[model samples]
Target: MASENMEISLPLELHPFVIRVLDDPDLQQRLASIVEAKAFVEESLKVAAEQEIPLNAEILASTLRPDPLGLGRFTSAPLQMDNWPPIGWLPTRTVQSQDGTPAFDWVWFGPHRHSRPFFEEDVRRAEAMPFNWLFRVRTGLQALISGYGSEPEVPLKGLIFHMSRCGSTLLSQMYASVPDSLVSSEPEPLGGVIQWIRLAKVDQESAITVMRAIVAALGRDSGTGAKYHLIKAEAWNAHSIALFRNAFPSVNWVFLYRNSIEVLVSLLRQPAIHTVENLMPREMVELNDEEPRSREEFAALVVAKIGKSIITHQHLGGGLVIAYPDIIDAATTSIP
Candidate 1:
């Protein structure tokens, strides 16, 4: 087979570094090696397909795989695995296939102590899945087509939104504190769906459908007396309020924000990924019709956008608004 030099375009964020590396012959050789390895994998898979080897979901589920990030080589069956680590598990991220279909990769967690925060719990998960690539799993594509059929204990209890630096994590910790609550703080699959929806790679209808399935998948009752299923989205998810509501209209929603300066300070001390300018699409950023020139300005714009979303949603008769200071009190009284 003849090999052609493939021109790859870097994302806007990477263009500067990419330009610097463009002239490096070593980099070019490394890129070519990647291409050659990809071609080898494709040819191997093609030979397997020609031999009529089984590549269904069941087989894929049991087999070990080297390419965790690639979806094209697998069959259509959606991926599922048993014997997930003791603390329960969650999808780490979603990847799109050549056809633009999304698939999730699940990560297992170690035991989580009752009093531990989400970050600590995550640390436990990472410990359990240590150097995860060493122990691999094959995932197929049909799972989504066949429907993973993740059954929720009951329907989702509600959605949580917030401005960056607000105590949404603490709020999620409080919810997790409840013996019967299943609180998923920013599962990556939902974030992927939101991005897919915004990019028009996935339609609103399909996005809603996938969102419901994901919530259900994550909302498992496990006979553990889990009554309330709460999903805390990424802070900037305020931008997609309507899309989410469209998916689960009856699910109550709440937006949490702090004083502007306090929020600004929190962000300045440690910035969230979404606060980077041009990181999000223009429509989603909603920077008050102004382009921010600096990181601080971008953080300010994001905070303002979140506040505006909450107030706007409140006026639209959608959901409750909880201030940062009153989170505990509001949770005690307002949240049902």
Candidate 2:
């Protein structure tokens, strides 16, 4: 089969220091190999597109859209994994810390010979990439479709929106304990789907595809006689309610809020999480010189955004507001 033309452009200019390092022949060769692998992956996707194969939600969410940074450069050629390391190049993994403590793992695959922990900047870049957004949309769509048609013994009650560290996870776990209920915690598909929604040129078909996939997956997971599928997404995805409502108008929504100060304090203390980049204004950063203060302000702004989003959707009906304290108490009682 003839290969389709595939191109991915990087969002940021390469740092001068990094550019100089690429002068080395060895590094250049390794980088070329990585590019080749990306091309091979893209080719395979082209074939799938040509064949009109339905993509699973997980794959759709991660790969279809053009990355903002143009890093969606997977190869269409077959990969020769025989010589690669057994662990191979999987997306970042969570691993134990050097001190034997539990820590979030941040791994990457590239031409660079040495492996080091990714910093906040690296994560921000990854999140901005178009491919990452595409992957999320594809995956969420697949999951939704899988869950939709199955017999729903239990009607889906509603969805909950929250800020991170606001006890949302705890709340979701609690709701899962209801008889015949299913709960999906911080599923990756939502993130991918939302990324596509944020693009200037939105594709309604793609959005519908994703929403259907998530709903279907939820239904299937809940089983034939099960009740609701409570989906708890990452705090950053609070805006997803808009997309969800667009696709499934009748689905109810519940937005959760907490004390801004407390939420900020909790997020800053965590390692391996990305700090704000393009989202925050320069003035906001300048006012809060300290990292903690900056993080607090950022969290406050994000929470405000989430609140506004809820309000915007409230008029449509079936939206509720839940306090963090109430949610925590509810979770404690609900979870077995």
Candidate 3:
């Protein structure tokens, strides 16, 4: 066991709960075990980081350490085992198995473990994929379809896209302020599935199945009889518009565009921008350059792709496209 050279603290919100749990002798023992397990996982991560492992299959397998009980119960799973791909090269999960059966279910790093078969199933489906881009598209489509057959259903509000940053979060937060509107921040898990589909050349039937699972999960959090369920996706996911259009013809689209230089600048600063490694040469060419002729030129190119997507949606007879500047202006209006 590694010596504890530093003391770790829980958040203020959990301090009281921690104290209460510690006061009980049996609970204290359990808590101690959890702490020890966590420390072991953390130390393994530290070593992995120092060694500069990519947090992919090889590193994940190497970091899998056995628990005190010698049951392979304290080790972490491969990042590929996670529902979503790792952000950059960061280790994303620390799983455990008991008697060769997975003890800890797939969980994102957080307190609230919302256990639902749909979430887990979707994660498993996504793990089969090589990447997540198409997964997101399929998930959105499935969500749209589920709402159709669901009892007391609400219409989807809109699908928003942008060319990387450019205040999409601010816009999403503003939209979330509206009553009964369920807003999901950059839902990237689906993206992983999508990427996998493209890489693995999955059949349409398999893709559809994966898509349906994700949609059902998203629908689980929606308010009963709400007017809209807004999903904001990563910027490069422009291709998903066609999938959404085919699945839900009535949904609207809000296509956001910013200066290319600004978008590139923002992407470079952030560690998680989706790359164009899987795209065609022509498509990559458009995205390859860091500079644009002008903001309007960048906006035009954005609008063109969005327009193409909109046309496809329109051909399918569904969805609306609104500009980000226009949405910002309207959001600030005083009139009801």
Question: Each model's TM-score, in the order given?
Answer: 0.66, 0.48, 0.46
Every candidate's lDDT: 0.57, 0.43, 0.40
**Whole-model lDDT for model 1 versus the true structure?**
0.57
> Could you give candidate 1's per-residue lDDT for residues 160-253 as a string of tens digits?
8888677888888888888877677777667766776776656777777767766665554445566677888887788888888888888888
Q: Candidate 3: global Cα-lDDT?
A: 0.40
User: Which runs in model 1 stand beyond 4 Å of their true positions?
Assistant: 1-89, 109-116, 119-127, 130-142, 148-154, 287-289, 315-318
Candidate 3 stretches greater than 4 Å from native? 1-155, 221-227, 275-324, 330-336
- lDDT (Cα, 0-100) at 278 in candidate 1: 73
State how far residue 297 of model 1 sits from its true place (Å): 1.2
RMSD of each: 13.7, 15.9, 14.5
Best-first order by TM-score = 1, 2, 3
